[model samples]
Target: MLEEKKFFIHEDWVVVILAALIIALAVGGLILPVPEFNWSNASELFQTVLEPRNLGIIALQFTFVFIIAAIGALLNKRPLKGYLISFPIVYLITIAALILAGNSQVKAINLEAVIFSLGLGLIISNFFKLPEWLKSALSTEMFVKIGLVLLGTGIIFADILKAGSLGLIQALIVVITVWYFAYWLCKKLKIDDELTMMISSAVSICGVSAAIATSGAIKGDSKKLSYVISMVLITAIPMMIFMPLIAKYLGLSQEVTGAWLGGSIDTTGAVVASGSLVGEEALKISTIVKFSQNVLLGLAAFAISVFWTYTKHPNSKDPDSKPTIGVIWDRFPKFVLGFIAASLLFSFILDPATVSSVKSSLKNLQGLWFALAFTSIGLETNFADLFSKQSKKPFYAFLLAQTFNVVVTLAVALLLFN
Candidate 1:
């Protein structure tokens, strides 16, 4: 008798369902209010961020997310008891990170909450040994996939086209050129395929998201994913701070500068920060360009999944034989489907009024999910593992690829935007 596949919903499908439900709830009028985290000082921190109303809002947000996460855990057949006990602790840590990120000084430096989340978790994990239950409860991939799905809602195709056709054109040229260059460089450096893929995607596409998508598609090690994320975040800081100054020194036009920043910078937050330093037009153009790239994430993930399935799957019985369509389908990440579906719904199906109304709420939830995922990643990662001697080659490759990305994006930007 063939085993009953119908009874078992794959974790990827569960992620898709959970992501859909979250979007449906938001669009169906359950608009969760985003809590205020902006604070200038200790006084304002207490008076504003920690005020009764804000605290209540935070509590409500936590409850909503916790419930959704719990449902995901249940559907995925995770140990509910451990997840229940551990998730709140993670949320508390993430809240502290959010508060830290809200500080005026932190905001001034363009430090994001996810950085703090990762840092705090690293501090805890490195300092003390964790219980097995807590370790098992870390649903890093689940959180990330759900966040990616939610991310799709913000990638409204019309918005990208309306903003600038040049932005989309630049995104395509930059991503394709940079990805291949990065991939070839990593291969030449003899970095393992997993790190190669993650590093390549990070350099060529939107940094963290690309890395995450690649990792998910390939079933990569979380430690490697964390390493790639750390590199992206760390490299992003200097890029964000100094790239605008470089643009000004070169006397580049705001449009070219924006295109360069958006195309080259790994992270969206960094792109925005760098663009803001140049001018309002730079910021606008940079954001449009970034969104154009963001719109390609689902397609890239699908392509990567198919490629990985065909070429690198370890379980293939015959190394020379191409996998059947059913085998490929089985190996494909279902969350990418959710991502594409969400993007399509937002792009064409939803009315502007409905989309506008629910967008902020969904975006907040998306950010929170990513923050949670990073916290889990940090907790699960060992500092030693990330910085082992083996990582040096990939690090060098990433820096070199980023440099290539910067040069190529600048060339593309000047050619198109100029």
Candidate 2:
């Protein structure tokens, strides 16, 4: 039994590499190698900005990944079997519902999310226990890092900067308040330090995605990752539904409120959904705010890691036992690379036509790749066991962080914008 289990883990590297190659190939096919196309300024209605046609293109491309993940989970019964199966299954269920309902764009985006989750789920479920050699080659940590690197390729920091001084200030204030408060609350609630940090960071930063990347970077507990994700998903839908309504009641400009909510919310997918409820400008602003928050991820991780080292281990010299300055660099998630790269390419080039095509391509690949990573995360961690713990600390931390973010961001946006 021991030998069999050992071999199982060793086999994971094969899955990791296979998963990466497929994702990379898809990206190359869609956006990496493609040339930009340009179109001059033209006034268009807000509804027209998110072309349903473009979303459809994304969905069609990602369906294969979802199917593989969902089907593979049904066939496996090893560790983390629930999320391993749920990742793909959820995608199929959600995307199929959208497709059947004739919401083509949503169907497409969901398709991308699903496929991305599926690939990751399969890899994490079965391979996490493989040989040290295989584990070394393509662990979840490696994939998340690589994903960050690839993400850099898709962002244009300059373009984000164009949103101006207010955007930067709002993002900075909101992220700082939320992250700090969440940490305090979690500690008060007596949650383990690692889990507390992750939940707080996820809520105050860019939501589930940010939480996942940061968790991977710091080698956080697996159970901690699941809790953060669960909170994000649970809070996301209700927030998405009510936030726009709240904005309307407050007489807040759609753009302002959307930006506030997007930056403050705990998940990117939900942010996009919430923004669409308002208008195109709101949608655009919200995404930028959210992205700006995302831009700070690398810096934030490093800062937090420094804090953890001094606080978590005052005297321990063992590098792995406590935070090491080197760990931040070694563990710095790589998806930031991909995000930064894309941003720079777009900012400098700014060729509308080619840029759009490339952006779309990268978005699709990012979505799919993320889905795979999600699957891996879900499969490796046991959700049932976690729920049983009733981690009051994490919950308290998330609530406090989100509350602080809302208060601080709103105050700033009002003072600055008004």
Candidate 3:
């Protein structure tokens, strides 16, 4: 019986399998069409977004992902009955958020669907009492890892190579420098290691996405992850609006401004929106810089996993005790392997034509998974815990790190792009 129990699949392994299976289906041409949600006005919204055909597409998407969620629940040895009942409600809520995000006015401000998803979930979870079964069924980590694995397909190495050498250089310097800076600040502030890592990654890397990835890699708490994510999203808005004004005021060139904005801002959408406020040249350069930074996400996750397992694992308390390779491997997040594999397959193995055909469908699924994860995160998190007295130090550390990020990135951009 002990031996049999040993064979019970870990959630991480199940995520890898499920992600790979989804990728296989996408590559095999079982592509689902992305529904049109963009609308400028209420009338247009009704005519285009709420059209019967579009509604059907949305329903189909829900059905596909629901099946995938159920399969994941089954493989993880969780109770499927509760998940089956709760997932549809989650899906509906996420859809409402998606529609709001898809509105033209929301797009103008560069708000993401996940933000609304998080907000709605928070509203529901905070105001009402939830059942234990519903809470139990919220598989936030699994959903995040699967979305991240699917996110890999978009991180084509070929595109990264073609982006710009300078962009890659800036990304490397900024991520490493800002990460350590944030970490050191958190340490000085007496923040816990988990919050420190999540905050550092969110500030230095790519905001919500980076925080989510780091949380999954380290198996951090959802409440802490939610806190970091909230900080990222909230700070991003002001940064997005003000950075361009500051750049213009400094008499910076579009190239320098673009690089600065790209490196400093957390989210891709925010980066793009901020850059566009500068000029077309700025828009292009900023995107290249952001994309370059995004490509490093996989490598960072791997390094963090190795470092965390080697130094922070329960068995690694003794300084002289070296963790064996097998132990490290056992501790690694297998979904990261799936993430890298998906990237490689899309980058080198698949033909461009095939990639183009399925890219939209896969991207949609990826966003949906991320949205679902954030919703779960919001549901699982308590309002007071998310912003408790204990969070002040981490919050201060993040702001200080972000301020440093902005100044340093501007200097780098001036040096490299000016």
Candidate 4:
């Protein structure tokens, strides 16, 4: 007899279910009185976990982990026993990293939880051997997609509008210019198309999320994805801490400095950290500029999907076959649609107070999911392959592109905000 298909539920359905659950929870939090979750004491994981107020938050996290692990077990055609055994291990490790990241000194320097989580996971995976069952449930992409969908709830269009036309103009200029320049530089460096696309997207857009979305669109290698993520995270820290200092040294106004940090820094968290280092007004401007760039993520992913599908398919037998709308749709990353929908629903449908309340509760959960995903990336990646000869070109190209991005964005910020 033929072996039964391992998974009853399709992967696409898992995406849909997870996205719906996150959106539903956000909405529910608005109507219900949900306890606020804070990461301020993340360094004291044990103490924080024991606190009565954090009990609900911990339960919520475990619920998500259990759900995803169960679904992943089904998809891999594995026994749920392994998943149950492994998820807590991964979670505990992630929690420890978060705790370290939450230390006052670490937070002051902008060492984000995601970075620590990924680093700790890498150390464990490299220095010690892990059980196969534990590795099986890592599910890096799945966790990331879910996190991105939840992240959508935080992006409000009203805030984008409030950012004003100058912010939009600055964002557009930085994104388009940096994107093509990075793409061309990667091409010149002789990196492959998929890797180049991912690097460019990460540099030009929202860093890890942009890279993940591009990888999903083009069906890129997980190793390459991990490499790109590593680069983004490693570079983001110094930039986050020093950008504001540099702006201050130059005597740039808070608004101009905020716009520069927002447009230049690859990660949103880093942007916020850098912006805050400047002042309240700088933080506000930086957030607006970053959000304006963030709003373009879905569109950029869609455009890249169409371009890659039509221009770069190596197996296409017919040289002249025109790509139809259906082909583009098929190649598109479905999670992006969910991401956009969540943003729109939260931004347009909910009243301001409800949105604010929902965001406060849901934001930390989103960070947790992303932390888990980055940890998974570390677990699944081999250090040797990540630092291979083939990876060098892309790394240098990314560095050059990011340098160009900083200079250009600073110029644009001055032109627009100064």
Highest lDDT among the candidates is held by which one?
1
Give each model a TM-score. Answer: 0.97, 0.68, 0.96, 0.91
Compared with the true structure, what per-residue lDDT tens digits does model 2 show for residues 13-87?
Answer: 333343444445544553333111111222221133234653454355445544434333333322344444444
Judge candidate 1 at residue 293 and give its lDDT: 91
TM-score of 1: 0.97
Superior by TM-score: candidate 1 or candidate 3: 1
Count of clashes in candidate 3: 0
How many clashing residue pairs appear in each of the predictions shown? 0, 48, 0, 2
Query: Which lDDT value does model 1 have at 143?
Result: 94
- Cα RMSD (angstroms) for every candidate in the order listed: 1.5, 9.4, 1.6, 3.1
Worst 10 residues of 2 by lDDT: 34-43
Off by over 4 Å in 2: 1-143, 314-328, 331-342, 349-354
Question: lDDT at 346 for candidate 4?
Answer: 85
Tell me the lDDT of model 4 at 350.
77
lDDT of 4 at 95: 74
